[model samples]
Target: MIPTNRLSSSRNSRKPVCSRAVSRRGLIVAGLMLGLLGAGSAGAYGLCPGEMENAGRMQQRILREWPLRSSSDPASRFIQQLGVFLAQYGDEGIPWRFSLVRNLAPNAFSIGAGNVFVTEGAITFAQSESELAAIIAHELGHELAGHFCADSYSRGEGDIFMPPSEHYEVGVGSIRQSIDPAKEQQADRIAVSLLQAAGYDPHAMLQVARRLPAGGEVHLHDPRRIHSLERLLAGYPPAGGLPDSLTFKEVRRVIMGETHQR
Candidate 1:
């Protein structure tokens, strides 16, 4: 067990919401701890006793309790088909299953063992099939990379999973942290390559690039707060980066059109 004193000390130095604010970083530590093994046969992602099962429960409740259930439209099914297409190429097709979450939030995320869930709002916001594919492909990329098993460790961070999930708070934190800035960028590069390898349009990723926040341009990236991912997809400072002329503004216009996101 991590020393109580050390945990207290770590908590004291943090901001009021520092636990959450720095949550992503702590998640990284959990993952790095696993790397200490130095070498091994890769285990699995989201196969922990409670990991995927817990996620299923969480999602099921959301469907039951939330007033905003996803639409049962054909478009949603179509989106699922697109996801299925991209998933077959993933390293974990048998274990992974794709689902479209009927929520609005313009968010897309995945749980290990092939659980790729994309929000309805994110899909509605997408201008085309390829654009949607870009987001799904990116999340799928993380699952295929074995980020879950990579982050799981006896680091004793107590499994930072969200409350009631039998995971340490730190274990949950490390999930997002598994891919650091460098690893994140590498993942994006790999996402694009994977999408292309699967015969999707390479430039389809540009739509996601354009949809990123404007503040990101200053960093020479797609400023969506996913810094590592943005820089990788935006590609900059040479080294096979995107052509210098492709600006965020151009991409933004295509995604935003005359209407702006509030």
Candidate 2:
């Protein structure tokens, strides 16, 4: 009888202990979530759990399938240099990579592991160096903030910044949809900051926004986004900075076929 009573007392004592443990765990999880929200607001990019482990492997696999334009090409080199300059402000110790794709669609995307890619059409579409930098900066922002990694898990695939084969009715009709509204805004904000830090006019982003064709190969027209960009640019009025250089002009001339060189 005494042993039975002792057993009951022991079980009762453990009940409060178990409850306390669960409560502590819940508080810890809540704290972590709050911290993540705070970081997001501060423009600090945080990867999802276990993302760092798989990002490299996934990036390598995707690069194999994606046709990469040769880095030795003059046009490709020009884009790469611009992307590298913008990427310098990203996370340290990360090996930043840039590639210019051969596709003519005005699209740019970033996979994980600091790998950023721009289509030839994007370069041809930009009116100025700042405009092109704006596009690259936006993709860099996506990579820095780990949006691509999060998107990959959500969609259960390697490439999250592109649409599926079925969605392709014509040339890159669905590529723009890969970036949802919230992520796009977040990336834009980050890109603007990066551009400003790199001595590029933030207003150049607005110019590109205005230039993008409505329902075109690149991003479709979003009035809300345009309004937001306008507001952001208003904060940074245009001042003289890095405008189109001779090198940039040469690259554009070659890309547009305005000059033919053997």
Candidate 3:
């Protein structure tokens, strides 16, 4: 990546401002979370990190074999680049990485650490930079919140909706496997804060949410992209010109490829 720039400003106040009036569950660093996570969690949640790393490596190879409609997919590249901004440079830990997978389902998901995957359908479905990033940030919240680590124990208690199911690292610190409606809501709240903290517009995050297939029932065979979107904002689309809320510099920088170092 080109010389990295700060996510908040040129301008990374890695020490998150406690007075930002963060939402109840905003994804803020209590203090250098990523650094601390890297240091500890060696014995407990360590397996989660290993699982994430393995998933990332596997997806990278899968993308290598994906058949793209064309060689140039700026939006796809944008997703990858933005991911580097949020996961690598950001203070929040549990490193995230991005990849595009060939699928018709308009969806995306992050498993393990920073392992986020966007289906071809999703890329084709998104109209602008914000929709794609909204999906990505939501998934990132799951990874950061340690949602994947639940697979191991959840298998005995109930069904888990994850792939490479049996590979859940046992050594990882135990994260709650509650699939309760409340937890889903909590994850969504975190996504909103994460996107905002990363300088992506939260309203756009809602756009991705409204476009999702909605109803009282959730599909079993279908992926959870929209469900995840709904969780992020409880089915409300970001109103007004969310673009107006973006930091002028961050928006210009991302649009101009000033931060496409990845």
Candidate 4:
């Protein structure tokens, strides 16, 4: 596990009322899931008891607080399919669940235990399916690397629940847990490998990085991170990967339509 101290401490301390409400709901949902699901063994991930319990709670909280696009929605299905496809190339310890969030921020995050989420903003922001795949692949990298468990353990609090005032900014930013630069680079490397293995244009990772705002609390888009990706991709041939599909275009259109209707 990556050391918890390596995780960045930089975060905005503003908590909106809605965020607090979500925390309360999360606590309630955590209790219900604990009763229904039981605190199973940590299994191969070697998660601590608290980490295992909190993972289920976090998943439930996200589902309850966010308005996920219906599974029947084309955009929702597309993201789920792409995420599952990429996950096949990584760890298989937990069942993966991918869903599109209805929020307008171009964000993606993983809550460990194979749960990944991408927002409608991300679907529209991505120019091609490969770019969106790059995002999902990156989140998979975090999960596969066990960053979540590491961060939770580092807190020494034995709980995966973040402070109520800590809010992960929307858009390509950190999760509720602040991932440090080294871990970010590690995830980026894993993302490129996953993309290559899954037949996505690995350079699409660079393309997405280049388009994001650089240098801020959003370290995910820092120029240093982009350069690291560039170095990582230098050896791979750029052109032979999969092309954008009609389905991707259709999903984008559907998501955009939904966004406009709101």
Q: Evaluated with TM-score, which candidate comes out highest?
A: 4
Candidate 1 lDDT: 0.45
TM-scores, one per candidate? 0.51, 0.68, 0.52, 0.71
Ranked by lDDT, the better of candidates 1 and 2 is: 2
Model 1 lDDT per residue over 1-262, tens place:
1111121123223222222212322332332345411121112222433445544644554456434323454444555566666654433212655665545556666655466667656665665555667778777666555443323322232232223342112111123222243433444554565455455554556556667544421112334425544454464232232232222224334334423443
Better of 2 and 3 by lDDT: 2
Over 58-153, each residue of candidate 4 has an lDDT whose tens digit, in order, gives 666676678888989877888888887776555334467898888887778877667788988888878888899998888887766666653343
The whole-model C-alpha lDDT of candidate 4 against the native structure comes to 0.64
By TM-score, how accurate is candidate 2?
Answer: 0.68
Off by over 4 Å in 4: 1-50, 150-175, 214-220
Sorted on TM-score, best first, the list reads 4, 2, 3, 1
Ranking by lDDT: 4, 2, 3, 1
Taking all chains together, the TM-score of candidate 3 against the true structure is 0.52
lDDT per model vs. reference: 0.45, 0.60, 0.45, 0.64
Least well predicted 10-residue stretch by lDDT in candidate 4: 36-45
